[model samples]
Target: MKIKLEKILNLDDGEYRFHFETAARDIGLGLTDYEGHEVFDRPVVTDVVLNKTSHIYYVKLYAASDARFLCDRCLEDARHTITGEFQVAYTDLKSNREVYDSESEVRLIEIHKANEITLDKDVCDTLMLEIPTKVLCKEDCKGLCVQCGANLNEALCEHAVMQMNANN
Candidate 1:
């Protein structure tokens, strides 16, 4: 959602509050196109504080989503809860370029308008960071049968092979 901060920019020192619901699909993170189960019952909330003089805006976001992941070990379906937090600065495009801090992780946003800002990209970035690299049903889960391509987690296969005696 786009928030208008024209009023806030007009004042010497002021604060503005905004509350809105933006669709995940609009930001390209919709469950329909995502490679997993749908995300249900969730919305992204953004609370921003804009400083008129500094031309910098501080944004805080909270979001949650439900996702289904394939277990790395058992190959079973696993449900995961994805949540994340982000703090970023939105600066005016006309401001002098500042050197990035090597010691800290800070995302810089170039602001085009003094009173309007879009939170779509920020929300999408936070969700992407929440995705886990590896997903497993359990730590000790048994995988699938390599010979018959059967899932060992459900049942054991009956295929057997004769073993050669090692004793001479």
Candidate 2:
């Protein structure tokens, strides 16, 4: 959830890679899906790349996690993989004031006093935005039988047979 800049801060212009795996809740992403299933029950895996160019640093964060949810159509337990990637830039300056620009995805920080950077908020927002609007067990789900309340994917219900006979 946090990247300690003690090493990267001193290194010259280059790309530094970091990898970590942590619980989703640690990054403030303990959430539930539309069906109330825990969306972040699995651990979040993150890969970070920091590119230092003189006083400017570019950061890219890639995060992924497996989530469990109830199929929207069949109402059965299903698994989904959620992923998010974000990029931001930071400028290290000797100025006393720190500035953040949401529109530009950039921030200015005082490198002399700062030892680390927290990415909890940025990770949370990225993962949350990637949650699927609709979840399904498969591409084609038969769902349930409206008349008999039975899972149509398992088997055809008597009501369906009767309705088909009536129609014919």
Candidate 3:
């Protein structure tokens, strides 16, 4: 998505707000793209606000989606709530160079003398940061029995511990 600066670019100090939504297919996002990923029918919703105080312009982006993920242990369907919030600073300076420092906990994106700004890249980047390293269906997932490959959470297999013990 892109935001035109015809109204805000000329003003020395002002606040502007805009909102947009995108489908998973539109962004080329799929469940297989993530680890143990699952996806429900939900669109990504975003809210953005831009504020200018004197020479400094501040931007905030909020994005959220209802995603489904497979449980890391039992492989059950897990509801994943993914959300991202980003804060950035913009300056209306004439420059062709782009600067980024990944050391900061909160990343900063630079925008130079541009009449408009596209948010697709920034939104996707923020969303990537929200992905969890591990997804679990519950706090304690028993997973599957080693022998029968049955989900222990659903029903305990008769050959669960006994078979392994007898073999030892």
Best lDDT among the predictions, by candidate number: 2
TM-score of 1: 0.59
Q: Where is the poorest 10-residue window by lDDT in model 1? A: 159-168
Query: What is the RMSD of candidate 2?
Result: 2.9
What would the per-residue lDDT of candidate 3 be over residues 47-88, giving only the tens digit for each residue? 999897654457799988888878888887888879999877
* Model number with the top TM-score: 2
Model 3 residue 150 CA deviation in Å:
0.9
> All candidates' TM-scores?
0.59, 0.85, 0.72
Q: Write one digit per residue (lDDT tens) for candidate 2, span 62-165.
A: 98999887889888987899899999888776331134454465676665777788787887889889988899999999898887789988988999788779
- The alpha-carbon lDDT assigned to residue 114 of candidate 2 equals 75
Model 2 segments more than 4 A misplaced: 34-36, 94-103, 111-114, 166-168
Q: Which ranges in model 3 have alpha carbons more than 4 Å from their true place?
A: 31-41, 95-115, 161-168
lDDT of 1 by residue, 108-161 (tens): 444442446667777778878988888777776777766776676676665312
lDDT of all predictions: 0.59, 0.82, 0.71
TM-score winner, 1 or 2: 2
Model 1 clash pairs are 5-115
